[model samples]
Target: MAVSMVGTNSLYTCLDMIDKMVSVNEGYIAKAILALLETEKCVVEGAGAVTLAAIMEGKLPELQGKR
Candidate 1:
């Protein structure tokens, strides 16, 4: 499933949102998201990336398998 983090707001600006579905048994995905955002300051202020981070890491089980 794909998690649509790009809301009606203009957080994404003009950056392209990349959605990738991944297995979630382990915490690798979240960890990766945190690491990427932490190390990559260029991705800062990009609402699309932020939304992707939430989808890949923050969302709960109820949110998974659906969006």
Candidate 2:
């Protein structure tokens, strides 16, 4: 979860969409971070890696053949 004193309305919206679609949580986010660090040699925050996590966890199977 990101803490922004400015506001989190947009963040909440994206999180809600992730929850409803892929049910991503902290575990997935952590896995994404580690995978990125190992493979891409990059560091990313939890929220920044949610989509990668979903792809890594095979939540987007529909895209397999399309790609």
Candidate 3:
């Protein structure tokens, strides 16, 4: 099987930092994709789900309760 890689080189540094902060593993990615499919009725690839995964994993606690 051909393994596909996610994420872009332009955002690699930022993504790496977020991954470290939130532990963006396969499980979180899977949950993000499932959530998009169920709620938005659309399919999203791994790169596209990174932000959602971070949010779902609650990595941005600083943004909590801020509008």
**Candidate maximizing TM-score:** 3
**For model 2, what is the alpha-carbon lDDT of residue 18?**
59
Better of 1 and 2 by TM-score: 2
Tell me the lDDT of candidate 1: 0.50
lDDT of each: 0.50, 0.74, 0.74
Give a tens-digit lDDT track for model 1, residues 19-62: 44343423444555556678775443333344454556655444
* lDDT at position 65, candidate 3: 53
lDDT of 3 by residue, 13-55 (tens): 6775554444576788889999999999989898888778777
Candidate structures ordered by lDDT, highest first = 2, 3, 1
Q: Can you give the TM-score per candidate against the true fold?
A: 0.26, 0.57, 0.58
lDDT of 2 by residue, 1-67 (tens): 5444525786686775553456466788899999989988999988878887777777877655453
Clash count list over all predictions: 1, 0, 0
Least lDDT summed over 10 consecutive residues: which range in candidate 2?
A: 1-10
lDDT of 3 at 24: 72
Model 1 lDDT, residue 46, Cα: 37
Residue 29 accuracy (lDDT) in model 3: 83
